[model samples]
Target: MIHLKKIKIVETSEGYGEEVLKKGFEFECGHVNLMVGDQGCGKSTLLRMISNNSKHLEITLADHVITKGIQSYYFDTEKDNPRVKDPQMYTSLSGKDEGIGYVGALTSRFRSHGEIMENMILDPLKDAKDCVVILDEPESGLSIKNQFRLIKEISAAVERGCQFFIATHCYPLIEAYDVMSLEHWKTMKGEDFIKLAREKRYDGTEKDNSD
Candidate 1:
């Protein structure tokens, strides 16, 4: 397993300049590691920095050094920027699906966001091995039911020796993984967050919609 001991970003030139993290933010490494918070709380920023493998960021790994080019994959529901740019890249990364013919047309035209994620994200993860997979708000386009289903896909990837770093607010995801709250970069109790989510509260404020 890829054991990420800690991460610290001191300057903007290095990575996401968000200063939400205290110096030397730390967490225990696990099969499914999560960074959870409301929007603009720096979750995506941290994930972005990790995905870029930013040299300026101080990332202490129990197993490997960050500069040695560890094989990693990054997936955002909004972007399909995987570490390796294969021919099968999807619109989730580039804002445009560059596929052609039947498969391409189907992916870009007929599929909903959730279906597209399943085809482009979860499908690749099904066979991922011995690498880190980073996801930013992966539950963006899924329904509550699909959010739970996403957990199954992620769990399968974990069983295959793939370590995951995910940024999310989805209650199901927070409930299913070990999570840190970007609000303080401290361990968060999933049960508490789940209770808040059920009440449509995020970041301690009541949201207008239900979970």
Candidate 2:
């Protein structure tokens, strides 16, 4: 399990004021923790703050810090750019004549979006234990069917003791796991507010906003 006491952010972009999460939030590992919110609601920022590989943000993992000796992988689809344009180039780069072997099998050597995700991001870490996987909108180019498939893959990883911190707006993906809704992070007036609510299970019904 991992606990975060607080997270503070100072906006250095000229003219933008400071924003701080004075109270912070906490969530347990060993299960998928989904973060859902509107754009600019700080979902990605919070993920960055908790990530071990983040360069700009400073984070302190308080009690039950399991990050030490744990292999962490962060997959940001927006910034992913494969140098090889085709399967032949990939084969040459990888030094393999056939398809790129992944997840204990051979997959397409072509550089399609979904294939890229499986080959570069998901397949390598699916069976890992005691690791932390952070994905920022991994459902970018996948179809609805593929999104659900990805969810099942992640669930399997979670069952194997791998922790996942996912930042996404996909409704089906959000419904498929334990979720921490960041809806209360902002108000109609556009100010920072702390409302951390954890839903241990999603019942396939509409989200409850009574809190």
Candidate 3:
């Protein structure tokens, strides 16, 4: 299984730049790391940076270090479509295709938005034993029921040795995972964080930016 020990963003270019995350923002990795914060708080930007295969970043795995994380699989909810069969898309650390062929075979059965999103998030877990799967707001089209169901699927994947880095605003997802709050780089736990998040959303206290 692939184990990411740490990641430090030393530099970033374009779109929000270093303001989103300073040069020294070092994050200790988790089995299932959830990046949570208000909209445009650099959640997606951080994910993009990790998947950019940048040379300026430092990625430390359990067994070795790498300059670029090209082996990581990134799925942007707004940009990446699971229905599209792109066999050359992602490759696992084990040097195998990250199951895009399976997506082609199964995407025909998923016609709804929720189904597509579900397939997008779950299909990789099928063969991603030593792969790092990064997902950006996968709950965009999923119902609340499916959101919780996705959480369950994630937990199952974790047990199977697939590490996840998910960026989302879904309360259930935030409450269920190990959250890295981008607001202050503070970690928030269940219940209280959810309460504060809800209050902020209803009272118009949190600022929303395009991430």
- Superposed on all Cα atoms, the candidates' RMSDs to the truth, in angstroms, are 6.0, 9.2, 5.7
Highest TM-score among the candidates is held by which one? Answer: 3
Error of 3 at 146 (Å): 1.9
TM-score against native, each model: 0.74, 0.58, 0.75
Model 3 / residue 124 / CA error / Å: 3.9
TM-score of 1: 0.74
Between prediction 1 and prediction 3, which has the larger TM-score?
Answer: 3
Candidate 1 lDDT trough over 10 residues, lowest sum: 81-90
| 41-83 per-residue lDDT for model 3 (tens digits) | 7888888777774665787777633544335678788766655
Clashes of 3: 0
Q: What is the Å distance of residue 75 in model 3 from its true position? A: 1.0
With a 3 Å backbone cut-off (N, CA, C), the pairs that clash in candidate 2 are none
Question: Higher-lDDT candidate among 2 and 3?
Answer: 3
lDDT of 1 at 30: 68
Clashing pairs in model 1?
Answer: 79-92, 79-93, 80-92, 80-93
Tell me the lDDT of model 3 at 183: 76
User: Distance from true position, residue 101, model 1, in Å?
Assistant: 6.1
